[model samples]
Target chain A: MSELAIQTKDISMSYGDHVALDQLTLNIEYGEVFGFLGHNGAGKTTTVNILTTLLKPTHGKAWVCGFDVVSDSLNARRQIGYVPENVHLYEAMTAQENLRFLGQLSGVEDLQKTIDETLELLDCKDLANRRVGTFSKGQRQRIGLAQAILHRPKVLFLDEPASGLDPMGMKMLRDLIVKLNAELKMTIFMNTHLIGEVAKTCTSIGVLNQGKLVHKDTLKNVMDRFGDDETLERLYLSLNTQKVA
Target chain B: MFASRYIMTAALRANLRDQTVLLIAGLFIVLVLISAYLGWSATATVQDVYLKVVEAYAAKGQIAPPNPVPDTPPLGLLRNMATYVALIGALAGLVLGNKTVSGDRKSGVYALLASRPITSSGIALGKILAIIIAITGLLGVAALTNVITFMILPNFSLSADEWFRLAQFYIASDLYVISFGLLGAFFAITSRSEAKSLMIPVTIWLTVTFIIPQLTANVLPMAALNPLKAMAPAPSGAFFVFTQSVLTPISFAEAYRALAATLLDFAPPGFKFQSFISPMLTLMIVNGLLISAVVVAFGKMDASRSAYDD
Candidate 1:
């Protein structure tokens, strides 16, 4: 078993009577692109929030990069980069300025160089000087990706990273995720419902339904169990329906 | 250190971007100008009243007038302007301070800033510094305007002592306003909505600056038992009787009498004390307590909690 970059043991979160995440246990290995597949309100964002140290778990424990998510949050935050579902950037600021601000907060040394490289990596060098408010959704998503990877974090928690992007933009993001995983050897923990993107990018996948991880396996294992004849979407539906029965 | 500087810069930028701040500054300038004009007029009225009273006494052929004629000069106009300018400075401080924290919450900028690595105290202090800079800039302009207006006025002559007194009053009044305004900001930061935050400060200002002072002036028996009167108690041969009559919860009245006796050149014997404390000491202590309370409340607030959440 490779070293686990993220480990959660029976972690649970509740907002009053609503259970956002219920005793969810997950382990993601280093350098693996793990796709978290779930419908809306399936606790994917909540799990990502907990792993990124944006939120505290109501119960159980979570660790990222060998530091407790709650007790050693500063270390955990330093180790992981987070891209929220919506690419919320300061609209008034230029792409370069936005990246610089986030980079500084992340304690990135050689901030200017990092911003340049990240912008170039996202193929957004031309738009760097333009205000982000003028950018398209795809451009904003790219900028969001650049900010997330600027600090060279060990793990990246991308909550719907391809959301609101056009087909071409989605393809570009898929390619970028693969490149990050293969070349950088960085763990990508992505939450998405786009099975096509998952099929292309992720090596391992987990299916979450109603705050429970119903399936966790490699693409090969999932294909073998459900057969290559059937699509992953159909297999996911059947599995979920079976659970309902 | 760099983070604090960055935060301060960001706060200043936000203030500049806010249209409401600009509007408030414009209104404050108008108020200052109007008040300055009114002050000039009021001082002219005082001069006319003095002249009339002197004329009335002259008709009686009294060689030595009971009251000296009040001087009407540019110096007096400047002094009047200074008083109105101080009030304007206080209003500016209050408006800026109340807006600093509450405005952030209303604009949703507080949440964005809180998501960063900065603490609540840092954010609060940065905002306070921004408002201070804004208020100081506005007051500087008003002061310059006052100086120019004084230079244009006829017979305007302000000695160094007069200028210093005006400056002293401005500093003290601005500090007092900022302190209370910060307290209001703290309240706004912890309140559910901006309306409540604004209301609390306005209510406190009305009570402390207007209502309480009026109540103290009218209800406080110290005025009737003037210290000057106590110094001349022997005119009625009732020194001991007057002292006993004035001895109750109105110790301040007696203290004022003692103070007058000490300051009066013709005060009788046996009324002097070796050591005397001024009432300004009590005011200083009260101001210190209010400021400390505001600082403590500001320090304890959590930047992460939304205004509606609180």
Candidate 2:
């Protein structure tokens, strides 16, 4: 297997004249929780979409766990799980039902047992039998997390996972992400604008400005260098300002 | 294959829970039952009246007119079923097919599906299989209802040949209904707006069901609903001849009616069908094209932008 869980080379995506992702290259090692920080329309979702094999980049190449996303999408998909910004499962189905379908698609051998174990691990076992339409955003997020980790994919992609969560919800999600990474050894790529959540959850951080990567480093290293005089938010802003100039 | 099966199951479960789909299917089944009951009631009433007239003629020592009731084929009693299937059943199919794709698209589940190990073709196959199963199940219920109605009605026994003909009638109806389902699904995959996806196929359905028949077959608006009248020879005119030549091959609704009427053994007096192959072939071709269109649309669809515009 390739050492990198995710890799991209000069990957650019253009929609007509507007470039969603410019000639950007990135790499993330296996088992690292990488936070991708970008403002709205900074091509964060586009990047996650490309890595997850939901959309192919217009130019350049990407791979997930040694499989090219475009040429070997199925194999690449087999190694990854994704939860979009707004997780929309079949509303009429119960939480377990939704998980069962997605798990089966992932080729889970002992599906029922896996579902039970995953739900218990997420601490939302009580939400299993209830219809997803009735759940709040936080409850749905738990179920969404359950689906992504059901197959124990080597890499998990979360696009704006903290967008609609309350403080407790955010904490629960952060804890779950950390648990999944530490326990399952899964590589996580999370895209968000919330620097605070990044401080709490992500081990490494990359800042994207105007579809360009402005800064990339481990959280500890970044904090060591820029933490004393300026907050991470100010540091993030300064990086974007420099990129804009 | 396994992924397709899972998708099929998920789609079926979601469709079953959908109120709009449920209502349309329920209405269709109920119409089938009612059609059977009404056909039986009409046949019984006509027979009773005919018997009474025969008795009066016997008392007067004059021969009664030949029995008109026996001249009607046993299967002909359910001829109205063809119209119901053509209209209401087709509508049911459209809704079912639309919901299969649009539901996922609208709910943003397509993103999740696209990220799975399954290919787009697998997803399409699963959804198409679901439509096939659902439409077949509905038609099966209608067929069983017809059989039960025959068993309960007095003097309405079906022969082996009649039973086979009844089955043939439904098979033809199935093809006609499934085509509409595929058309709806085709639009759902290609059209950006959900309303356009549904409305476009509905407009096509309306055109084929009513307008095309009137132009090409010289069938009146209401006569289009009756299988026997729908097959009457078109009136002689250059315009009619041109339309008939141009539209007949593509007029699946007319073909279905003619094909269904033949199976049910309904025909106007002294009007002989030149051949059954023409109508049968038309339906087969039309269905084949629609299926291909659906497969192609699904294969080429961009999953990232599949969500509706409106």
Candidate 3:
């Protein structure tokens, strides 16, 4: 297996004249909880799209689990799962039904068994028969995570997963992300602008500015240099302001 | 490739579980049963009247007219069954199509679907297979309803040819229904927003089912149920040519209507399907092309970004 779970080489994406991701090179190793931070339209979702093989980058190459996203897209697709923001899945379907449908699509063997185990692991075994439409945002987010990891994918991509969550919801999500990383040894690529959530959940972080990646570092290394999460926030804000100036 | 089967199975379950589809199907079955009962009641009335006439003739010691009025077409008992399938069945089909692949698209589930090992074409094919299964199941109910009516009617009996023709009518009905389904799927996938997608198919449905039929029935007042009337060559005129050329193609529903009229043996005496083959083939080809277009559209889709499903 390649040491890296995700690798991008000078990747850029442009929509007409609007540049989304600018010649970005990035590397994330297996089992790393990667928090990709950016303002709106700063290419966080775009990067997630490219990594998940949902969109192809215009100017460069990307690989997931050593499979080129464009060329070996099917193989790369097999190695990953994605949960987009506010993805209220098949609202009419029960939790088990939705997971069964997705798990089968993901080609998980023994799907019913997998669904039972996955729901249990996500702490929602009792809610399995309830319709997703009835669940709160935090409960739905947990179900969303369950679906993403149903196939035991090598890497999982979540785009602004905590966007609509309350404080308790956010804390629950952080704990869930940590549990997934520890128990499954799964690499997680989360896109978020919340510095607190990032400091709590992500092991490594990358900050992007105006479509360009401006900073990349391990959370431990950054905290050692900056002293604390608040100092890191100040550093992030100052960098954005400097770019603006 | 294996995922294709799973997708197909899931799609079938999802389609079957859909409440709207089930409701439409239930309504269709009730309508079919009512139609069958009406046919049965008519059969009893006709038999009772015949027995009275025979008894009267025997008492008077007069010669009977030697006329046995046979219900010429076997399945003619449920003649309105065709229209029901075309109208109600097409609605069911449209519902099925809109909710299958496009449901996932609107709900943002296709992003996860795209992340799976299945190819886009595979997923589309799976849904297509599900549509076929759903349509077939519906048509089977229609056929069974009519067939049971045939077995129970006292004086009515089905000839071998009539049996074959009844089956043929259903096959054509399946084609007619699926064309609308393809239309529904196409619009569902390509429309800019979920709310707007339904309008395109509904407009087409209204035009094809009610509007076009009414127009054609006005032009050829008995076009739907009457046997084709043999006529001389058209006069050299613009209106005649447009009616014969432009309007006929757009009124593809008439193709099924005419074909059903012939199979039910209600065609004007001496009318052969040879004259109607062109229209039927045209409808089939047009339907085939539309389904292929939807498949190609799916092939080119950016699975990551949905077209505003909700």
Best by DockQ: 2
Model 1 docking grade: incorrect
Instruction: Give Cα-based local distance difference scores for all models.
Output: 0.65, 0.88, 0.79
- The per-model DockQ list reads 0.18, 0.86, 0.74
> Chain B, TM-score, each prediction?
0.63, 0.91, 0.87
Across B1-310, the per-residue lDDT of candidate 1 in tens digits comes to 4555565566566566667766767776776687567655665666677678778778988654543323433333433333233244444556666666665565444433444444545555566666656767776676666666655444455667756645654444344445555656666666777777777766665554434322333112332223223333222335533543443222332232233233322234665422234433433444466455555665565433444443
TM-score of 3: 0.91
Off by over 4 Å in 1: A1-3, A182-185, A238-245, B33-116, B143-164, B176-310
| Model 1 global lDDT (CA atoms, 0 to 1) | 0.65
**Backbone clashes, each candidate:** 4, 0, 1
Docking class of 3: medium
Fnat per model, in the order shown: 0.04, 0.87, 0.85
- Candidates 1 and 3: which is better by TM-score? 3
Using TM-score as the measure, which candidate wins?
2
Candidate 2 falls in which docking quality class?
Answer: high
TM-score of chain A in every predicted structure: 0.96, 0.98, 0.95
List, residue by residue over B147-263, the lDDT tens digit for candidate 2: 998897767788999998898888888888888888889999999999999999999999989998877764555666766565677788899889877776677787887777777
Error in Å for residue A214 of model 1: 3.2
- For model 2, residues A1-245, the per-residue Cα lDDT tens digits are 99999999999999999999998889999989999998899889899988998888999999999999999999999999898899889888899999999999999889999999999999999999999999999999999989998999999999899998999999999999999999999999999999999999899998898889888889999899876877989988887767632
DockQ winner, 1 or 2 = 2
Share of real contacts kept by model 2?
Answer: 0.87
